[model samples]
Every structure is written in C-alpha cells, then in structure tokens.
Target: MKSAKQRFAGRYRAPGPKRSPLITPEGAAALKAELDDLWRNKRPVITQAVGEAAALGDRSENAEYIYGKKMLREMDSRILYLQRRLDRIKVVEGTPADPNRVYFGAWVTLVDDDDNERCYRIVGADELNPSSGFISIDSPLALALIGKQLDDRVELSDLDKGYEIIAIDYKSAAAE
Candidate 1:
C-alpha cells in the first residue's frame, strides 16, 4: 500500500480560511497566465529532466531525479489549486454605479485627524498588495471606508483612530 504522500503525490494541502471569491480582471488574468505557464512550459521541462535523471541510474540515490520529483509535486499542487480557484471566483470589472461612495475597486484618499493623508485601493483578498496600496475588501480599514462619501468622517474604535474621506475615485491616483 502507498503512503498518503505517495498516493497523493504531495498534492494534499491542509484546508485554509475560505477566501473571498471576488477578483479584479487584472488579478484573474495574472492567475490564469501563471497556471498556463506552469502546466504548459515549466512542468514539461521538469518532467523531461526527471526522466533523463531516472534513465541515468537508480532514482532513489539520484539527487537530480529526487529534486525534480519534489519540484513536480509542488507545482502539481499549485496547478490543482489554481484550477479550482479560477472556477469558483467571480471576476469584478468596471466602475461601480455610485463612484462617489467607496466600493470594490475604488481608490480612496483619507486624511487622519493629525492631517496625514493616505491612499488605498480596495481589492479582493487575492489582490492584496501593500506596496501597491491595494487592500483587501475584507480588511478592517476597507470595511470602514466602504459606502462612505467624500468628506465623511470615519472612526476606527479598535485603533482609536479617526479619518475623513478627502477624495474618492474608481481609478488609482494621488491624493488630492
């Protein structure tokens, strides 16, 4: 009988917190392209390398063969995850009906009580990038910003912070 690892080929991953299924068009495209590249290009090259290593001699002691197999298992797991994620996620596009109020994909500017301004774009969980100022809609800050309009005062009780909406737009831009 094969061990669980051998039977699954290392494809099994422990369940994680359920991520929100909303993704921007660009985020969806990026994920799809990664899936295609792994399945079509990278996997085939690694498979060939493993085959060559296997043909050379005993695979159990062959370092190249072992490494290639390990890489293959990891890539296969990611491929499976991408396939399932793409199928279930909803791709959000276009500006919201009410652009004045913050919504998914909205770039909002807020000034803290100390008069420091910050800008962030509300995106899905898969698209969160702090450096790029893209925050997940599930985040506390984004949650508070949603449904708010320009000049609206927002308060975060947990952090004892308060901010006022300075600007709101569907497109990312510098704070006004």
Candidate 2:
C-alpha cells in the first residue's frame, strides 16, 4: 500500500560502500579507552541520576526523569556502537613494509602546482580530524596517495587539483 513517492525513495536510498576495518594502534587504544570510560564511569552515573529522578515524582510530567532516560539511551547506543566497532577493527601496528611509499599511518607531505605544501596523516575513519591534518584512509585523497612514492604526481579530478608527493614518513609527527 506504499505510495509511488515512498517506493522511489526507498529504492534510491542504497547503502554506502562498507568501510575498511583497519585502524591504527593509537586509534584502537583511544576507542578502547572511550568504551571503558563509558561503561565503567558515565553509564553508572547516568543510571543513578535516572533512578533518583524517577523517585522524585509522577513519571508522566517528570522533566528530569525524561531527560535522564533520553541521555541514558544515547549513552547506551554509543556504547553498543563502540563495542561492535572495536570488535571488528584490526589495529595496524608499526609501519608499512615500504616506508618510502604512502600507506596507512604514514605522514605524507604534498606540494601543489602553486608551491603550497600540505601534510596529512592517513588514519582510520574513526580518527579523522581534518584540522589536525589527519585524513581517513577511505578518503579520496588518501586512496590516491596510497602506494605512491616521492616525486609522484597525484591527480584529483574531483577537486580539480593535483599534488606531488614530497615526502613520506612513518614516524609520528606529533612526537616531533
């Protein structure tokens, strides 16, 4: 009994491609720490708050109780997502076999035609921070950079730009 519009919408909304389950060691550790904090600390605190709010008055009109319940649900949902993500992710340790080429966890330096230099670290999707120069491995730029060596030109047709690989280092740039 669905309308044509509804059927068209459902047919057009295809799922996105599956993301790779590879994660850097640091990224994995961060996720684990967050999951632990949620389960051991935040969850208990919210549960207690919800209990206290429920005891205060009638459930129907209780704003505090409703808010607490909503917060608890959000927290639980995030915890579940983290648990599942952690279970499937494979932590990539050390460096790539070919350190001279761009790969996951590599700090890459690129130069544009205008002589502008940019640096980025290819990392897991969960750890991407554009402002911090961390790019997800699934990103188009990272995909283009992968396996490319020094002095190699990478064409990004979508962005209408190209970059030359200037340097590739596996060491953590943040430490330096």
Candidate 3:
C-alpha cells in the first residue's frame, strides 16, 4: 500500500560522523548572533507573512502561503541546528599551548613541491571558508598539520602531495 516516495523516504542511510566540539571564539560569536537574528527578526516576519497569506484562504493553491510555510520550516530547522550546535561547542580563544606548532586556530603558511605558497587558518567545521583559506580542523590537511612545527614537511594523502610549513601565526579573537 506504500507509495514509491514513501518507501524510498524510509530507506537506510548512514549517518555522518559527529563533528568536533571545538570552535574559535569568533565562530561561536557568529553562530550566536545568527541564532539571535533568526529568533528575534526572521521568525517574527515569517510568522506575520504566513498569517497574512493564510487569511487569503485556499492555502493549497495559494503560492504565497506555500512559499511562506516552506521558508518558515527552513528557518526553524536552521534555528534548531544553531541552538544545538552552539550549546555543544567549546570556544577556543587566546593562543595555542605551543606557540611554535600548528594547532587549532593557527594560521599556517605552506609551500608546495612546485614552490607555490599557500595560507590557511585551521578553524572549526562551522567556520570553514575555503575562499578565505579557512579550513576545518577536521580536514585532512589540518590533521596532517596539527602539532607540526614551522619548516616541517607534511604529506597530504587526500591531495596526493606534500607541503612544508613555512610559517605559523596564532591571532587572537581581537585581532580577527
């Protein structure tokens, strides 16, 4: 009696491994700000829109009502995720225990075999911004670089290449 869509929806799918609970102070602040904005501003506006749209009647055919409901659901999902994530995360501020080695929140400069230089900041999963060279602490490159000192050579199996640590800098939350 089950439809194809209903059967497929219940199919087994492996859950992803849990992310590390470590986060930079800045990342934690950003998440908190986002959560506050969603709860205080976005949810209220969406609720009003949904109410107005529903007043038009025939929600099944009202595009405005449908779109508003969809958006409200998405917003609620994000708010819940943010709330749980923020609650579990531990904000890492100040400098690493070892100033000479690469660790979480370290800005690392690396040189490739071809002599090309690159820079990346090892941050939390919630703050990974590839375009700005911020990589997740759970990333393969960060794993390889963790506890590595400047001038240390790191082999990245994922990239099938090796890079040498050229510089390591730890900027505080204030500097960022």
Best candidate according to TM-score: 3
TM-scores, in order shown?
A: 0.85, 0.90, 0.92
Residue runs of model 3 more than 4 Å from their true location after superposition: 1-11, 172-174
What is the C-alpha lDDT profile of model 3 across 1-176, one tens digit per residue?
98897899878687887788999988998999999999999999999999999999999999999999999999999999999998899998889678999989999999999999999999999999999999999988998999999889999777789999999998543389
Where is model 2 more than 4 Å wrong at Cα? 1-16, 173-176
lDDT for each of the candidates? 0.89, 0.90, 0.92
Clashing pairs in 2: none
TM-score, predicted candidate 2 vs. hidden true structure: 0.90
Q: Higher-TM-score candidate among 1 and 2?
A: 2
Clashes of each: 0, 0, 0
Better of 1 and 3 by TM-score: 3
Candidate 1 versus truth, CA RMSD in Å, comes to 5.0
Residues 75-116 of candidate 1 have per-residue lDDT tens digits of: 999999999999998988888888899888888888998999
Error of 2 at 63 (Å): 0.7
Candidate 2 C-alpha lDDT tens digits along 1-176: 98898879856867777888988888898999999999999999999999999998899999989999999999999999999999999988887778888888899999998999999999899999999999999999999999999999999999899999998888774343
